[model samples]
Target chain A: MIRIDAADDPRVAAFTRIRERDLTSRDGCFIAEGEVVLTGLLQRSSFLIQAVLLAERHEQRLGAAVQAATAAPVYLAGQQTLDGIAGFPLHRGVLALCRKPEPVSAADLLGTAPADAVVACAFGLSNHDNIGGLFRNAAAFGAHAVLLDGRCGDPFYRKAIRVSAGAALTTPHAVVEDELDLIAGLKSAGFRLLALSPAGRSSLRQVRPAGRVALLLGAEGPGLSDAVMSRAETVRIEMAPGVDSLNVATAAAVALHHLSGRVEA
Target chain B: MIRIDAADDPRVAAFTRIRERDLTSRDGCFIAEGEVVLTGLLQRSSFLIQAVLLAERHEQRLGAAVQAATAAPVYLAGQQTLDGIAGFPLHRGVLALCRKPEPVSAADLLGTAPADAVVACAFGLSNHDNIGGLFRNAAAFGAHAVLLDGRCGDPFYRKAIRVSAGAALTTPHAVVEDELDLIAGLKSAGFRLLALSPAGRSSLRQVRPAGRVALLLGAEGPGLSDAVMSRAETVRIEMAPGVDSLNVATAAAVALHHLSGRVEA
Candidate 1:
């Protein structure tokens, strides 16, 4: 590992703006922190690695993973300096800079999944943590793909990536520019569009999936706007009467679990 | 609404120590920000109100709720002073001080609910925010109660309460001294004991509730310590083959939504 003593070293500067770098995607890249997440990225299909930053004291903590990397820049910093630079007190000894996976074309993603697969379409969920959590659920429950309609925060945003526990890196997803085109395409593909709502006549359990299913989810409040709701019929989760609905991310998980679990022998 | 100008006013000091409040006792209080959660708390039968703090700038946003508070202290502060005292800039013009509901004794909680009741029993989930999210799901899918076993965090802890959006106020729950006693008690009460597990023979859907059911959940990672696991039969949510598990809170919501719907219908 290359060693550095100054916080301002150009090598560490990119790591310093890790949050902002992922937030704005100025360099079209984001940083992954902690050894597990970094290793996850390293093992995944051909993601571009920009660099690796670690504490000199942590070389043993990350030795195996570092040796596997062929060309990524590897640098060592003092514990205090690394902590000061990463901002979060617990950096877990390793962080990596990787090129953001190019957003998939809506056309390409729609074509590959099975005709009866369950896909999660998230809208207006600007909260990075929620988006990440959604992705984690999407991955765990076997969503064929997750799409972020316009106005949702980038699922690859740094905080979202971390909250997803590195699942965002493995889960196949795309952000499409045209909302209507994407929805129409799903319909053309024979997917039964089910929108999650608190007021549906029937809860999710009653809505059996017939073909490909695209579950449309929106932010917690101002839930799936009327414009979007009008596109797909509203569906409810049979809740015990009189409490507010689940958080968007949590709601997405249940929906994925519900939709996927159906027809599993 | 009574107006005050200083951040140091003792009248609002209870609001100030919010982040540090003791959450162990039934009467210990917590803060609920934003109007939606405040409205949820107002209508639910579970919590007692302790105080209401409002920003003078947003008095118009809370006139109705404040006018209804008969005896609870209503302290008003300027936006700047409110920000200073709150330790974070909060735009939610209204904040409600809510007393923790007296926890239903484990015996009473299990005794009263239907044999099919889907209860979430948390063992040693120490993070307040995760506990808060758990309560939010518990509230959403109609968990009969959230029982904090001996090792769990206080769900009434300030951060937990705030994160739960005040659902802790309306969700019937208790922190029992002994989990084994409750487990034995519930079994005798005819409640099916299902512990969520990554390794299990039965999918959650296949395990029909036999009257009242208590779902035993544990903290994320090192899930359901071996001792607790042995007490209950294992139940797994059928998942994507590669995926091992869902977040505990997410898994709780999935289980509650699926099981509660069966009973609610």
Candidate 2:
């Protein structure tokens, strides 16, 4: 373990102004915050860790993870220096700079999945919280993968990773260039594409999946585009009259839960 | 419409330091933000509105609700004045202070529900986001009322109200002193009490509700107290192993969707 005494120390350049980096770019590396996320990052073999920065107080609490961090240099800093390095309060007190996995094509993600896998595909999911929640739900329901169209936010973004409770790190996901093309790829792979919307001929409770299924979700407002809805079977959650549709994440939770049940049946 | 020119106008006292007032005290009045929430508040017969403050620009857009506000006075102010009054930049540019509805006892809330009603009972739910999501789910699924123990946060709080998409205004809810006693009342009201827990014995997909049903949810961590869960029939959502349980609000959504389907059947 090495001690980081100064905030401007080049060793901690990646951790400076975390929020600005979050909005602009992480380059090829993603920042994982909090003990839970850092622990997950250390355990995963898919991502390579460049370094780990932790508040001095959390050193003992995260001893196991630090000991097993292999060759990654562990830097411990005082609370003030840590906050300066992060450009924020740094409440969670731990951060990890990780090398993002190599880019994998949407087709490759689908090609590698098992026959009865359940995957969540998002179209224009710009909200980070919604993206994180969807990944958390997908992981909770044992989904094989998550696919996002170009417009969706990065799940590896700081807030998205935190909101996902580290599930984004464990879940296999890829971003495709075109949404309609991704839908077509799923259809070609023998996966049933189920488009979830407020307007649909089928109720969610009544629909049953037979084999590999891909749940297609859209943004909260201006729901699934007509072109996308027309290409797949549409299913709606039967909500009380006059009520707006469920939040995208909550709806995905219900759909993932329902689809996961089919695999067991 | 009454024109309010000054930021310090006494009539707009409710609009001052809204974020601070939101935390310290709203007294018997709650601040509703945005056009959607204000619309719900204006239409509700149970609560009386004291005043409506709108940016000069929104007058044309909200013409009907503003014109038909009856006895309630509508105040118009410049965007800058509204922001100064709110102690923050008001993006929605609309605010309403409505008198909180008369408190109803847990017994009274359950008594008024129909024999087949679905009520969401929350125990120790202090987080506003979770409380808001639960209300939204309850409203979406046509639940009759929501009951909360004293440990829960006020649903009428500004952030909760907004997060609920104004469902907190439309849905009937009551808070009780004793959680255990509330559970007992639910039993006597001919309602099948289902305690939702991660370690529950029965899977949610297999559970069937016959008559009046109460879905009991607890706070995110340190789940429902043993004293409460021991009394109600325990039910769980089948999830992928190693993944943490669904967020409390998401769990409630899945549960409400399942129980509401029984009412239709």
C-alpha lDDT score of every prediction, in listed order = 0.76, 0.88
Q: Write the per-residue lDDT of candidate 1 for residues A1-265, one digit (tens) a residue.
A: 7888877787778888455445455567777777657767777743467888888876765754665654776888888888777765644767777787767876678788787788899878889989989988998888888888778888667678888887888888887666676688778777788989887656787777767899988898888877777889789887766766788888888888888866685
Q: What is the fnat of candidate 2?
A: 0.95
Q: Which residue segments of model 2 deviate by more than 4 Å? A: A45-47
lDDT of 1 at B38: 70
Predicted structure with the largest DockQ when compared to the true one: 2
| lDDT of candidate 2 over B1-265, digit per residue (tens) | 8788889999988789898778886778898889888887766652467788999988776744766764777889999999889999998999888888788777888888887899999999999999999999999999999999989999999989998999988899988879987888888888898999999999998887877999999998888999998999999999998876889999999999988887556
lDDT of 2 by residue, A36-78 (tens): 7877776764247788899998777674466666678889999
Worst 10 residues of 2 chain A by lDDT: A39-48
lDDT of 2: 0.88
At residue B9, give the lDDT of candidate 1. Answer: 79
Q: Estimate, for each residue in B118-188, the C-alpha lDDT of model 1 and write its tens digit.
A: 78888878878788888988887788888888788777666677678777766888777777876777788
Model 2: CAPRI class:
high
